[model samples]
Target: MDETIAEALRIAEESFIASSGPGGQNVNKVATAVQLRLNVFALRLSPPVFGRLKTLAGTRMTSKGEIVLTARNYRTQEANRDDARGRMIQLLEAAHKEPKLRKKSRVNRIGKEKRIKAKKNRGTIKAGRGKVDW
Candidate 1:
């Protein structure tokens, strides 16, 4: 019931039907599109899974946090269905993975000291270019 995708793996429903493809003049009449619907809000996924999914899905996630995938590449019904399912699995697996945490690091002391020293030297070099008071 959370925003995570663990709920997706638990409650995923696959519905693959014949696709409408380049099957001659009669292909346009058939329904060949593969629609992969992951009910993200229905399942109780972990916070990490949900976090990953939100990042992976980008703008694909609906306003309510649901993900809808549509596959209509192949002209054949079965091929299109398989392609859609494969893509859905890939997306889900990616979302299931945990991202590595960033480790904090300190600024290099030597680098900082060199920067200050260089600035002072540059100012001295510039001052020597001024006109003499005499």
Candidate 2:
């Protein structure tokens, strides 16, 4: 993960933009929000890892296979930059892990019987709500 992050950082492009939200006059004057863009193709991830990363990135992943992350939670540019880089690292790490295969579960015979019994009871109750004869 550390090596992946180092490679990512080496190819990442960072830009600073003015942040929006509570920060008094500083928000208007200073550009603290950091936008980090990294080309996922350059990472040379496997097809499976790339698929996972694609799903994880959602709209953040561009058609060009670049992942863009924005961090403005902090007031300082350096802090925001670190936050963006950290998020990117987290994404890469998560992609590296393989998802566990799900085991199919079946309802026990007793549980199925109970469910069918309750369904029959519900049907009976509904059948009782008939219109009255004149």
Candidate 3:
């Protein structure tokens, strides 16, 4: 296992529950859905990373700083568990990356002049559509 995933799993709590969906009678009998709760504080992320994670997680994150992820797409417990863990790791990795800074841009003088010229041309074309006087 990768270091990041192992670290994430170390602080994660996993629970299996009866999953709803197309699994025939097996769905009711077997608990296939995996609910993964990861402790955000355990990850020891920087302030910026934590903020980014909070934004990225949205409602999935609890007030106590735990990220909750449920996976029921897979029919088996193992698959669902893996899916949940993978998603949590992916989220953490994404938060670790810094967002690209945006640079302000200004249109050149010639570009602005061309835009104004186009508007005038369009206005003239529309004006030509008016009813002609007898």
Candidate 4:
């Protein structure tokens, strides 16, 4: 299905420029890391979607209910930012998906009959294996 940008549900946030762990001058000079944040409670999504987002975000969601995503794999700031935004979009989309309801499953008539027939055959074989007393 096509997805439209959810401007109404959009969240504005900031990201800091920091070094990518232990690297020399290149890493220190270039801020390739991206950190994306969105307050779940502030989102305009339906209640069910917000609840599912809370569960899906797991530890990424803060105690106050904020969804955070960080992307640092890319070398450029723009690329990293896009990656983070894309991930957030995917996460929200997943949360918005309709959940499949569980339907009670009954034993199949054909399979049940086959299983019983096999059991009877196995029982006869076991009976023949019993001690042959007088």
Best-matching candidate per TM-score: 3
User: Highest lDDT among the candidates is held by which one?
Assistant: 2
Candidate 1, residues 1-134, lDDT tens digits: the string is 22333455446555555455466664557767777777776755678877877788887778877777777777766777678667766787787766688999876999899999999999999999999898
Give the count of colliding residue pairs in each prediction.
7, 0, 0, 0
**Model 2 over residues 26-122: C-alpha lDDT tens digits?**
9999999999999999989889999999999999999999999999898899989989988998999999899999999999999999999999999
Q: How well is each residue in 1-134 modelled by candidate 4, as lDDT tens digits?
A: 12323641256374857747544676878776878778766666778877888889999989977777888876777877888888888888888898999999989899999999999999999989978889
TM-score, every prediction: 0.62, 0.78, 0.91, 0.76
TM-score result, candidate 4: 0.76
Candidate 4, which segments miss by more than 4 Å at Cα?
A: 1-5, 8-10, 21-24, 108-110, 120-134
Of 1 and 4, the candidate ahead on lDDT is 4
The lDDT values for all models are 0.71, 0.93, 0.90, 0.76
Alpha carbon lDDT of residue 77, candidate 3?
93
Sequence-dependent TM-score of model 3: 0.91
**Which 10-residue window of candidate 3 scores lowest in summed lDDT?**
1-10
Error of 4 at 133 (Å): 17
Report the alpha-carbon TM-score of model 2 versus the true structure.
0.78
Local error of candidate 4 at 7, Å? 2.9
